[model samples]
Target: MKSSMHNPHLAPEKYGIMDGISECIVTTISSKGPNAAPMGIIKNSNGIKIRVFKGSKTYGNIMNFPFLAANVVYDPKIYTMTTFSNLERSQFDTIVYEDVEFPVLKDGISWMLFECNNLQKSSQSLVADLIPVKAKLSHIDAVRAPNRGFNSVLEACIHATRYQLTGSQKYLDLMQYHAEIIRKCGGKTEKEALDQLYRFMKTNK
Candidate 1:
């Protein structure tokens, strides 16, 4: 599907996103209202694919409604909240398309509305084929440059989540390595995010 909004910065190919995982906050509306989660999006020539596990609120909502929004954000709090807890309704705003509900993160840099065409379900998860319907670039300038500190924080967050799930010492070691990088090379925001991750790990451990 073609997007109505034109965003030069949405050129995934230029950012080397042709085939890799791009982290984003995915929001969907359920009967209970809106829910958000951190998701790693797989982008390729075919389209964007999202793997939503069965029994998850995201999977259930998309299965019922077949529409969701993917919001690109750089906020560490957004990542932590969505991954560890549900977001409050006030944290997001809504955009209505053809009466279809789309939840947009207030702090997101960009957002894309996706309509699920096919759902291939496996024993572990449901892979949804997403067709982009609407997209907007809110902070084009922000994403124009590369920041190692920010990237490290995102990578560390992924490892931290994995460690939480599996309690693997390997992931914990990796998380600590990334934390060191954040301490040495990260900026204020990166350091702040690292602190949050450390606090979470201490409590969770």
Candidate 2:
């Protein structure tokens, strides 16, 4: 285990990834094309770790090519969009490393390129140790207070993803619970994001 402070090639703290779980969007490329999904990563002295369920585009893409880019994003709309719908080509920017083109979010504030190592698989999930090989900061951090409405929207997006995958009513129930908070505290973006999520859920169901 190596501390990120001593690592020359990668530093987790620079990307606002601390000791606990940091939520971000992970993008991976396959023969078909790029895939994006909201993911939570844990950063420790051991490095970054991620888990993805089987039968997902992210899971299959990483299995074929073990390289991915994790993008730090603050926008709730992006979370909702990626969790339910496929991102258009225009939403991505490309960076080539050793002839492999990795898709990055144009709206990402910062991103880290990782090579998935120490692959571990189970019946339900694939867990990988992410080794940060490259990183970039796309925008300067703006000064803004914390918004619970925005955070609630992200939480709802997670529940929505779970509901989509498992077709469970409990997840849908949880999403509706968060919808209350979004209506009460969220701004225009959060409200719009929630609406889009509900629309997707309606059509998918």
Candidate 3:
């Protein structure tokens, strides 16, 4: 199907998305309310795709509404929070289209609102092709040097989330290895984020 969004090329460029896997905080409407989760959006020559597992809230929300907003944020705390638990309502800013209120992170650097064009489902997950319908460049001047600590925190958080879903010992081991790197290289934010992740994991168990 032809894209209904205008100037899609320009928006992706402005969002710093290219032909690779961009990790984002994707927000969608849930029966309870707005929900957010960490998702990897794949942008390739074929186009953008995201695989949402069948059991996830994201998958259910998309099946119900077929729209999402992918927020580009660098805050490790936000990632940790969303991965492990629900984000506070105060953390979101709403954008309405077609009478639907979509949540955008308050600290997001950029965001892309997408309509699910074609969804191919399996027993495990739904692989949806995305069409960018709207976008915003929230901050043009936010820049930071690469921090290994921050990167490690993200890696650990991913494993933590996986561990929760699968109860896999392998993911737990991976999180432990990444924790060492966070200790050696991460700053205050990375350390605190990891701490929160661990706390959430333990309490939820």
Best by TM-score: 3
Per-candidate RMSD, Å: 3.9, 3.4, 2.2
Q: What is the lDDT of residue 173 in candidate 2?
A: 88
- Please list the C-alpha lDDT of all candidates, in the order they appear: 0.77, 0.85, 0.86
Q: Residue by residue across 1-205, what tens digits does model 3's lDDT show? A: 1346644465576786667988899999877888999998999887888999887889999998888889998888988998878799988899977666788888899988888878899999999988888788989999889899888988998898789889999999999999999989999989999899999999989
Q: By summed lDDT, which 10 consecutive residues of candidate 3 come out lowest? A: 1-10
Query: How would you encode candidate 2's per-residue C-alpha lDDT over 52-170 as one tens digit per residue?
Result: 88988999998888888889887888888888877998899999776667899988888888888878999999999887877888776644588889989988988987898899999
Error of 1 at 175 (Å): 0.5
Model 3 regions more than 4 Å off: 1-9
Could you tell me every candidate's TM-score relative to the true structure? 0.84, 0.91, 0.92
For model 2, the run of ten residues with the poorest summed lDDT: 1-10
lDDT measured at residue 90 in model 1 versus the true structure, 0 to 100:
88
TM-score, ranked from best to worst: 3, 2, 1
Candidate 1: the clashing residue pairs are none
Q: If both were scored by lDDT, which would come out higher, candidate 1 or candidate 3? A: 3
